[model samples]
Target chain A: MAERIALIDYGAGNLRSVHNALLAAGAGDVAVTDSADIVRAADRIVLPGVGAFGACMSGLSALPGMIAALDEAVCRKNRPFLGICVGMQLMVDSSEEHGSHKGLGWIDGTVRPLAPSDPQCKVPHMGWNDVIPRGAPPLLEQGEAYFLHGYAVESDDGADILATTDHGGPVAAAIGRETMIGVQFHPEKSQRYGLALLERFLKWRP
Target chain B: MTLRTRIIPCLDVRDGRVVKGINFVDLADAGDPVEQARVYDTAQADELCFLDITASHEGRETMIDIVERAAAVCFMPLTVGGGVGSPDDARKLLLAGADKVAVNSAAVARPELIRDMAQRFGSQCVVGSIDARAKNGGWEIFTHGGRRNTGIDAVAHAELLASLGAGELLVTSMDRDGTKDGYDLDLIRTIADRVTVPVVASGGVGSLDHLVAGVIEGHASAVLAASIFHFGTHSIAEARAKLAENGIPVRRN
Candidate 1:
């Protein structure tokens, strides 16, 4: 039987694009669901988020038992998990956007405003940038990916840093430990590089 | 590598189909926006911009459907604009899979719309569009397809939009629109310098060299053109190559 992937939908933006990208990436059965029960029963989970960190977290939390279900599925069950953009930021311990907001804390870090050392680098880091992998992170490979965000993860454990991208200096592009992986760039918007990443993600065992 | 300068091909949509026009007038049928988007996606164009010129109430639904279809096939970032008047208008496009919503006339009428959109959806999704033309010694904002002069200082308007939390600015020069001359480099540089956010240079791109100049001279983070891509004057690969040859960082396929 094909592995069922649960794409959590909590009224966040880009749910449909992510869903369509997953299907294009060769997933056999992907379920777009808000039900925690469906999430708990899935073989893999993909969290996609857009907009503010606080807003996205609140929206996810607004869905009763969804947080616990994610925790149960990814932490306890050790299922393959992937988070994109704000979804990746949510994996950190907390975020400084719109005041201090607690996150999933799956990874030790804080989501802070992207302050590139060079003032000329610009904020929001809009457009395509290189995803320079640090060592080997499995799902992450060295390629150009589409990035559109003002905030980024500052993982506390340097060992947890899976990939880095340049803005003014080294910025965390992807962070993961064990079966969970998170990317600051949107794979759904990264075209071929993104689709290849998703293809690897679909086959990622750990 | 650093953040590559973006080359976006603008698609003007009317009643769910792509249309090409000069200076936003003299409309002619092009092709399906989804198909054009797929072509750009395959060509590795950095992103795509869709301008919904449909004015009818029912036409709105058709544009939404087109956006949905395009987003399905094209995984690159998509920015949709034209007639976005409210947060709800922006929401519908976002839900339809548009990565960003560009607001021009409505935003000029009510600057607060930019704030509302930036606050509700985050600045990344809110793109402030400034349509300006040379007036006296300075540039002034225009509306209604560069026909109506708002008598607003383009520089101050750009600063205000950026202050209002616009993530990016799409600065288009009415004087150069569809003229096949080139981008208003000074106009683009003025707005790009005033705002910290990325600015997309639009209007009057006739050749790949114009795209290179838009970044080198205009200092824009991205460059947008319709006629150049729609009419097949230059392919995206050739454009990227020219930009790359000119020392501007562009994504190599």
Candidate 2:
């Protein structure tokens, strides 16, 4: 049987693009569904979204049995979990976008807006940015990918950070511990460098 | 660390094939959009922008099929433009796998469209595309593939778009377009000073030095060119290497 990859679709954003990207990355049995059983049983789980932190949390909350299912699959079973963009921010404790809103709290951190001191520096840091790898992750061996988020996760425990990218300061780009990984940048949209990372993640035994 | 100067390859698609020219005139056949995208992908171009030049006036929807096919094949982030006049259109393109959507005429006609799209789909996905021509003494906004004049100051409009929730600006000079003389530095500087968003300097990029000048002198976030790349005059790798040598900090292959 082919390895099943469950893509959580809570109607946040970029669900189809993420699904298509996985398919392009050679994922044979990718299913874009919010079913609890399928999510729990899948070999890998991908959470992808492109919206505000508060909005994403609400979407995840609105989903029937989604939080419980994701928690069971990631925290309990410790299956390979990957979060992209706002999905990565959702892994943190809270965000500052639309006032204070609670997140999944999987990682102890807060999502704050990027601050570029130069008056010319734009908000919602979009487009391709260079990823400066701090701790070596097998997936990021290729190079940097595209990032399109306004808020970034500032972890309480800095050791969880896998890579950093500079805009105003060194912002955390990727975070992981054992089987769970969260990336602020969109690996699916990062082009060749991103594809290589996804391939590595798919092939990772752990 | 210094930011890298980006080399972007733009494709003007008419009936699915990539065409090139100055001021959208004397259209020369480039190649198939999918094939051209793949070539740029392999060549290590920083990003790709596909503009459906004739989609809007034709009263047709944005080409989602071509966008999807190109997105599936190309590894880099794709920005799709032309005929995206509303949030729904922007949503459709994003759903079709566009990393960003560039809006020019629509945003000009209705400034609120930028804010609405940004609110719904996040600001990063919204790109404000400006086509400006120097007239009399100041730069004026030109719409409909540089055929119609909007009588809006280019610099002032760029600032307005940024404030209205556009995440980035793709500024193209109609005067310098297709001239291959190099980008209009004055226009780029003017717009760059006005907006905080990343400004992609388009039109009249002839050589690698011109690309470097665009980023350094113009203070632009990226440099976009058409004829230079389409005619096989300069490769992305070579341009990046040259930029890196000049201390511009480009992603090395």
TM-score winner:
1
Candidate 2 structure quality by residue, lDDT tens digits, B79-154: 8888788999888888877889999998899999999998888888899999999987889999877889989998
TM-score of 2: 0.93
Instruction: For candidate 1, write residues B1-253 as lDDT tens digits.
Output: 7999999988888988777623322224336677777778887889999998988989888888988999999999999999999999999999999999999999899999999999899999999999999997999999988999989999999999999989999999999998999999999998888888999999999988899999999999999988877777788788888999999999975
For every model in order, the TM-score on chain A comes to 0.98, 0.95
Model 1 chain B worst lDDT run, 10 consecutive residues: B21-30
Q: CA lDDT, every prediction?
A: 0.91, 0.81
Q: Kindly give the stretch of ten consecutive residues in candidate 2 chain B with the minimal lDDT sum.
A: B21-30
Instruction: Report the poorest 10 consecutive residues by lDDT, candidate 1 chain A.
Output: A152-161
Off by over 4 Å in 2: A118-122, A136-138, B21-31, B55-62
- Which regions of candidate 1 fall more than 4 Å away from where they truly are? B21-30
Label model 2 with its docking quality class.
medium
Native contact recovery (fnat) for each candidate is 0.80, 0.45
TM-score of chain A of 1: 0.98
**Model 1 alpha-carbon miss at residue B179, Å:** 0.4
Taking all chains together, each candidate's TM-score versus the true structure is 0.97, 0.93
